[model samples]
Target: MEEKCLNIESKVVHGHSMFDPLTGAITTPIYQSATFRHPGLYETTGYDYSRLQNPTREELEKTIASLENGKHGFAFSSGMAAITTLIKLFNPGEHIILSDDLYGGTYRICEEIYKRYGLEFEYVDTSSIDNLKAAIKSNTKGAFIETPTNPMMKVTDIREASKICKESGVLLIIDNTFLTPYFQRPLELGADVVVHSATKYLGGHNDTLCGLAVVNNDELAEEIKLIHKSEGAVVSPFDCYLIIRGIKTLAVRLERHEENAKLVAEFLKNHESVDKIYYTGDTDNPYYDVMKKQSSGFGAMISFTVKKVETVEKVLKSVKLITFAESLGGVESLITYPVVQTHGAIPEEIRNAIGVTDKLLRLSVGIENVNDIISDLNQALI
Candidate 1:
């Protein structure tokens, strides 16, 4: 047998092995202590407190940074906690240009929390570089993008957007939750920072809640370190272990997820009840070329609208195999109504303007037998 798995898939499984240098175990053991004993008054073992760092969490962070092609990584108690810390990088007068069709929770933070603090934000169609260019103000400090944006599945050209941010001297931050590093590495495309909701794709099992941020440079890493430590929203050692375990099988899971999603999107396209589909795997999808250029695979998430709004409730109530749930990226399938579930926090006017209407439903295509997954949807649509 090989001493280590050498490919990216293998690396994900064994690269960050915190295998006891002492015991030669395969898995990294959780260092459950809140504080560590110092060697002496002036000496240390490199760890002082769990809030600042822990060996198990460090292993996960390092693994994710390597996967994302970044120099540093930080893990948080939840995805929102990670995003909140990234926002802290800006000051009261600084501004950030973001995707208009982002996760509703992100919009809430920008509008309700950060706006009150004088941190201004402009929401625009990031798919159009011209929109991003026009939205940048003198106070703009960063551009936050959600390529393959939630629900809408909009694919922004990361390389082109990165060029704009670099020319304007602004940071480029990408939310990589939908694609995960298994299919896309945003930092490699010139993004300064990449964030993931480990609760979704990264955790892959929907059994854990965690968030991660990876930074390209040492300076931003140190700055994030301060905010993460100060906020005390560090991910638990156990949860870090869970995420690490999830990543080990990410490659296989994603392959199955994408395969199933393509079949489902095809089925939806032919069904008369379906009005439109928002999956990037289809060559006719508006973002198909850009997605092909930036990612190894189109992600599993799919959104579609029905012919009539009344049919929405019928489909939701009729699905026998796929569960109606809030989260995604698990072995089991989940379907959600973004307007009422994930995007409800966003104002109705704004949501409608962005195409998040009551007739739309988002599917988190799971790694199930494609025929069965299709069969369940076929009955539900009728």
Candidate 2:
């Protein structure tokens, strides 16, 4: 297929290259030196400083941009770094409405760090487009949403939300971390910007810590570039390499992850202890149709609330094969108690409003054998 016509699987696998210009290796080598030696004065190599840019990082950025169907991509040291840089794009007195139930770290920085700086944030159930439309005001400049939101797993209609934001002249930013480019490209769906906690799905393993951002327009791209350069949280060359290697198998990993998640979701649905199960692949999911419309696959992240809060720790400690961990979208089938581990930063009242109560458990279903995963969960729940 022509490069432009290539599907996501091919695009991610065969990300552009003659490999590295220095050695022409099949893999992009890490340009480890912090400073690049110039040929002379203003005449120079493509890179000047590692902080400004690096060849390995640039290659990763290009791949991410291409994957997201956007014009520019930036890699950050961590997800929070990318987000903090993004918040700088807004001035004080400007308001950005976000999904009520989102990653707690996002809530933390916005509340503790940026709120003090004058940025206004309003949390609402963005799954309801009416709620989003109602939240917009004269000062509202942006709407940030996480489809299939954290712990609760509520999905929003990205295209519809984009339309609403456009009518109001507001930017629509989607945190595409849970789904990643393999499954969904928000920029293609009319989002102004897309960001990811690449540590989760993009890295594909429990190893690397990284984040990514992509912009549809040059104006936003330029502003983000300036903030990224000024704030200096660019992903390191080695982490860039790790993420690249991980992307090479993203399509394959996600396929298996989804496969196992289907079985797992079904298992949970009939379980006595599972009070509520959240997985887009499940046909009964409230947003199942919306998820099917926008993305190719529903992904492996599943959050369920057990019948009793006391069962939370029992399940957490009982699982043998699955790990009790915080992060998601790795190759290991890890489980997390969102009330404490992930969404602890949000106040109890707010967390309870969104159903991220003490009873909820988030599962990052891995590409393990379906029977093994099910057997493990069965034992845990027992």
Model 1 misplaced stretches (Cα beyond 4 Å) = 1-5
- For candidate 1, which ten residues in a row score worst on lDDT? 1-10
Residue lDDT tens for model 1, 289-366:
999999999989999999999989999999999999898888889999999999989999999999999999999999
TM-score for candidate 1: 0.97
Question: Positional deviation of 224 in candidate 1, in angstroms?
Answer: 0.3
Worst 10 residues of 2 by lDDT: 12-21
Q: List the pairs of residues colliding in candidate 1.
A: none
Q: Candidate 1 — what's its lDDT? A: 0.91
Best prediction by TM-score: 2
lDDT for every model? 0.91, 0.91
Q: Per-residue lDDT for 1-382 in model 2, tens only?
A: 5557888888778675526767878898988989988999887788899999999999989889989988899999998898888888889999999899999999999999899999999999999999999999999998889987887889999999999999999999899999999999999899998999999988999899999999979988989998888889999999999999889899999999999999999999999989989888899998999999998889999999999888888998899999998899999999998889899999999998888888989999999899999999998898
Note each model's CA RMSD in angstroms: 1.7, 1.0
